[model samples]
Target: MKVVIVGNGPAAVSAIKAFRKVDKDSDIVVLSAEEYPAYAPNCMENVIRGDIGDDALFYAGGFSFYEKYKVDLRLGKEVVSIDNKKKIIYVKGGEEVSYDKCLLAAGASAFIPPIPGVELGGVTTAKSLDDAKRIRKWILEGRVRRVVIVGAGPIGIEDAETLRYMGLEVSVVEVFDRVLPRMLDKHMADLYMKPLEEEGIRFYLNSQVVAFHGEDGWVEAVEIKKLGSDRSIYLPADMVILSTGVRPRTYLVEGTDIRLHVDEIKGRVVGGVLVDEYQRTSDPDVYAAGDICSGIDVFGRHRWIALFPTAQQAGAIAGYNMAGLKVKNPGLVDYNAVKTRMVTAGSGGLFEEADESHTFELDNQIIKIFLRDGVLIGYQFVGLPKVLSVNKNNPFLKDSITFKFTGQGLEASGVLMHHFMRYRDRKVTQKVLSVIKNGALRSLANPSHDIPLFSL
Candidate 1:
């Protein structure tokens, strides 16, 4: 069997490893648009901050990984066309390769919103290695001092932190009410925002950039509009960066046999190439994993949750099923963790703005849980680490819960329990349940055990 996988990010790497495990002799080819090896996308901030050298950010595997597995690793090659009927992929360099099975792990691209003067010089999107290199060069030239970031998401926040660390005046403008709105709520965001603002970062919440003002060819200022006001304000800026997050790169699959699903509220291609439990697309021969596929969350509703861990899980399952294995790709849960001088992690569901919530006291910490119809749908931790762990593993807690920790013992949370449960086939028992449930209790005897557990 011949397998052709597009993109060299986490999903593609996982797929390659899975394919080699099942069908070592199969002709496996990886087409990567990036010139470098696969690396963690989250490490972009560390690289910019000068904490870790750029070389260290590359994925653990080196060239030997491909040579040892006898896989074709094509770098700097773009797959532009897919002929479903012919089962072939046409590359940008005019190379056509037929594949018995095709996997689209193409990942996503940075979203650049439409705004006047956005095409001017000194404006860039921080998404790829090339982007990093260009930004680094601009900084080194000592021409960029005042910076304006157009998004207050994780990437934007990280960029602001890095720029401030480099002693540059930075301002982050967000159209949302809170920063990191996707990963954190308004309260949790305030915790991080305080520290950032203290470090000389300016925030413009509920504001939209209408135009970019430039002198000659470089950006000089930005025109923005604040919420609840019609007046526009101009902010001085030497450089502009767009960290508005990303959208699934479905342009290649557009007008093809593949279908794209749009989220009505967001009006973006939230999911691509709808797949079944086996990760097989509408066309059985075609499979998609990672950001290229639309997946259902823990709520059993269709939503796009694009994260590195989910991509890895989806890719492995797709590879296994493609190699004639009867493995069903367990759908993904929307999970994310953020730690910046403090740690906060959550999974499954979110405590939306339109929800009724309750707070409880645990030792010296406070645990706030969000419920919808008596189910523990979400939670927030803002105290001791021990208390955070206790709330994280509450048996009565809903499958979708978010936990935030302001103290040290957060690591002890049965965070790994869910992953272990998924990968292991052993039965769960009362003893195991007791251990997790009575984690906060010094005594296991006469413990509050409401559920029966099985042995492993």
Candidate 2:
């Protein structure tokens, strides 16, 4: 069997790994729109902050990763479209690839709003390696002194922290009332923001970017307005970053018969290609994973969580199913972690609309849990690495902690996600909550054991 995969990120590589385990004899061709190899998406900030070398961005230091895997790897090949009937893929340069089956893990792209002057030279998105290089260049060149980031989502918050760490004046403008609105509650958002604020980063919540102003085609400032008022203010910005988050890259199948779940707002493609639990799309021979697809959330509704781990899990499942192993990803609960030198935080599932919510705040950590009709709905946590773990200074965390870190080695958020994922259990979840209520979210999970499969 010749399987063609349309992507080069975590999802595509995961599919390759799983497929190899099941059917090594099948010919696997991986196509990447970028000239680079698979790199961790979350590590982009590390590169921008000059912690990791540029060459380290690509897995295995270069194309050697593909060579080692014994797969046909095609770089700089952007899949433009597909002929579902012929099972043929069309690249941007008119190249065609034929396959018995295909996987569309095309991933996502930064969402650029219709704001004017975005074409200015100093404006970029925090989405790709190229964008990271651009931002780093401006900072290293001393060309940017003040950076205005639009949106306080994960990317935006991270970029703000990175620029500030690099000694640039950073300001964030978020449309929502709080930072990480999708992942954290207003109170927990304050905790995450506190560190950045202490580092001198500024935040403008409940605000929107109106436009960019530039001279000589390079950004000079950004115009923003409070959501409830007509007054607008211009913030001086040597560079501007659009960190408004991302949308699924479902362009290749726009005219194809493959179905997509569209976001009602602006009629945009929200969920990319629709797929069953097996990652099989409407087209039987085609499967999808990563940001290019959506699955059921804890609420049994469709959601697109464009995180690296989510994509990786989805990719593995897609690969297994494609290789005839019959695995599945019926649904997922949101889980994510973000760490900087200053703070580590993460959240999962629903908030805002939960029927009952509880908060436990200590000098060392803060944890919030939400539920609807006695069912775990959502959660959030924020604190320093030491405080999140066994803290002798705090009575609640003296020794009961039995936790394992996840997602880029962030332990605090790992604790949050661990409890968040397993909290559905009648016994395990309540024990976790009770422990936190008494002292801290001491770990109930054994690091030696795998995350319970039921959590997925």
Candidate 3:
């Protein structure tokens, strides 16, 4: 079998590993638009902050990784289009190849909003190593002193912390009422306010950048408008960073015979490539995974969640199924964690979708768990660690805790998924029921051991 996988991110790497495990002799080829090897996108900030060398960014180091695995790699090659009828992929400069199976893990691109002045030189994005290099160049050349980040998501928050650590005055503007609105519940999000405030990062919640102003073709300031008010403010900025999330790079399938999942109401294929439990696309010979494809959500619905861990897991599953192993993704839940000099917070699942919620608060610590029908569904941990005995001096230095409810690794939102996959029709004994009722989430960590799974 000839397997061709596009993309060089976590998904593509994972697919290569899976395919090799099952069929080592298959003619496997991988294509990447980036010249560099696969590196952790989350660690790019460390590269910008000078905490690590550029070589550290590569996950497995240079082209030798592909060569070792006996997989043909087309680095610095852009896949222009695909001919589904002929089973051929066309690359830039008229390069073409035929494949029995193709995996579209093209991933996503940083979203650039329709705001004016974004074309200015000083504005950058937190997407690729190239963007990080540009930002580093600007900083090293002493071109930027004040940094304004537009968005308070994980990427925005991380960038703000890194810039502040570099001695640049950092300010964040978030459209939502709180930071990490998609990651944590409202109650849990409040714990992050004071720590970030103490870190000298200015925040403008419920506000958005309306436009950017530049002098001599470089960003100078940003014009922001507060929601529900006519008030507008201009913040001086030598550099502007757009952390406005990302959208699936589904352009490859456009104008092609490959099928896409179109929203019936919106009349658009805006979501992503639709894949079944096995990550097989509408084109039986083709498959997709990671950020580029929309898969099953925790609640058994179709949703697009482009997260790093999710991408790796989905890509591995897609590779296994593509290798004819017939594996499924189980389900995916949103898991996110962020930390700065002052605070650390992690959350999983859709707490707002829960029917009931509970909170446990102490000085500089908070834990909120959401439940539906007496079953644990979601949770958020904020403030200092649950216990500071591990590191007394630094309350912020705590191990990130992940509860394992399923056979999979530590999950942020696996309660519902565990029940759905393993305990859907099982009965809960009184002992197991009592343990769950008493917040026995820690007991579920040992998936290999006997901890009765709870049912809803």
Candidate 4:
């Protein structure tokens, strides 16, 4: 059996290992456009912050691991086209390879807006290892004295915090009203923003960068338009870092027989090549994972849940089925854990500002939850440690459950009973009740199973 996996990120790496586990003698080939070995995309910001050195950013098991597993690894080679009918992939350097099965784990690219002067020097996005090295070099050389970041998402905010720590004058400009609009609600975002502001990071909310001004082929200032107002303002800066969101890298699949979902308003391919329960694409031979594919979420909606853990799950399932194994890949639920000065974790759904069906309370250190249907969909916690388990549950749920922080007087047994009863009644369905009950029984019997319910 011959298998070729594209993209060489987390999803591609996991697929190779999974194939080897099932059929050790299967021929495996990994293709990556990046010149270096595979590394975690999430660690790019940390590398800039100096939390991890350049060499430490690579995966723990590097090229030697692929050699030990007898997998062929190809770096700095781009897979340009996939011919599903012929089962062949065309490369950039006039090379072609045929595969018995292929996994398309090609990830996303950083989205740069169509603003004038965006091509000027000192403008970059943190998408790959090379991007990080360039940004780090600019910072260490003191070439970036005043930095302007163009997005307020998690990556942007983390970059801002790290840059401030490095003694650079940093500012963040976002078109959204609040930071992390996707991950957090206004109340939760306020909690994070207050601390970051105190750390000397300036934020310009509801603003868009219209153009960049440069001198001697380098950025000098940015012209921005405030939301709901036609007036514009100019801000001086030495460098501009685009921390805007990413779009799926689906261009290679275009013009092929593969069908893609296109959004008329956005004017780009919105979702991945559609797939069914078994991770089979429109073309049976081609399978996709990670940001390149869209799947059904726990809420029964088709969404692109692009996270590292979700990508890994999708890749593993695709690899198992591609190897001719009979396995059903359970779809993913929306879950994220982020830690700054405090820790916040949530799953399933977020209470957006437009969501009238949800009611929430935010006080000094407590978060109260309620659902429009009188069930609990979500909750947020700050400065409170005891209520951590109250928020954790199985990923799937039919109805919501309310959560209230009882004082420290609450007994541990009582808390466990509350969780178990909720899990038995509201969270788990009758079909999966036996599995949940048996797992709970095993967990209670073993002391080693008593792991912390949450971690940073």
lDDT of 4 by residue, 1-456 (tens): 888888888777676666667777888888888887778777877777667764567673777768877878898889888888889888899999899888888887889999998999999997778888899898777789899999987678767766765667889999998887776667667765765676568899999999999989999998999988888888888888898988877776766888676566888766876666666678877788787777665444566767776777778778887877756666564444343322232223435422233222323232323233433343333322222232244221112322223232122222222333233224323322232233342332234533332111
TM-score of each: 0.82, 0.88, 0.86, 0.80
Which portions of model 1 miss their true places by more than 4 Å? 54-56, 262-269, 342-348, 353-356, 360-367, 380-456
Model 3: residues with Cα > 4 Å off, grouped in runs: 53-56, 339-341, 362-364, 385-441, 447-456
lDDT of 2: 0.78
lDDT of each residue in 264-331, candidate 3, tens digit only:
89998767889888888889888988889888866787888888888888889988888889887888
Candidate 1 local accuracy as lDDT? 0.70
lDDT top scorer? 2
Poorly placed runs, candidate 2 (over 4 Å):
54-56, 262-269, 298-300, 384-409, 427-431, 447-456
What are the lDDT figures for the candidates, one per model? 0.70, 0.78, 0.76, 0.67
Cα TM-score of candidate 2 = 0.88
- In terms of TM-score, the best-performing candidate is 2
Going through the candidates in the order shown, the clash numbers are 5, 1, 0, 2
Give the per-residue lDDT of model 2 (tens digit) for 1-456.
Answer: 999999999898889888888897888999989877888788888878767864666654467767766779998999998888899999998899999999999998898999999999899997898888888888778799999999888878877776765667889999999988887877888877776676588999999999999999899989999998899999999999998878788888877889888777788766768887888889989999989888666567777778887888889999999999888685676687765556667788888778888887654567777887777677777763332343355322214332222232255456656655654644335555565677544444444333442243
Residue-pair clash count for candidate 1: 5
Residue 127 of model 3, lDDT score: 81
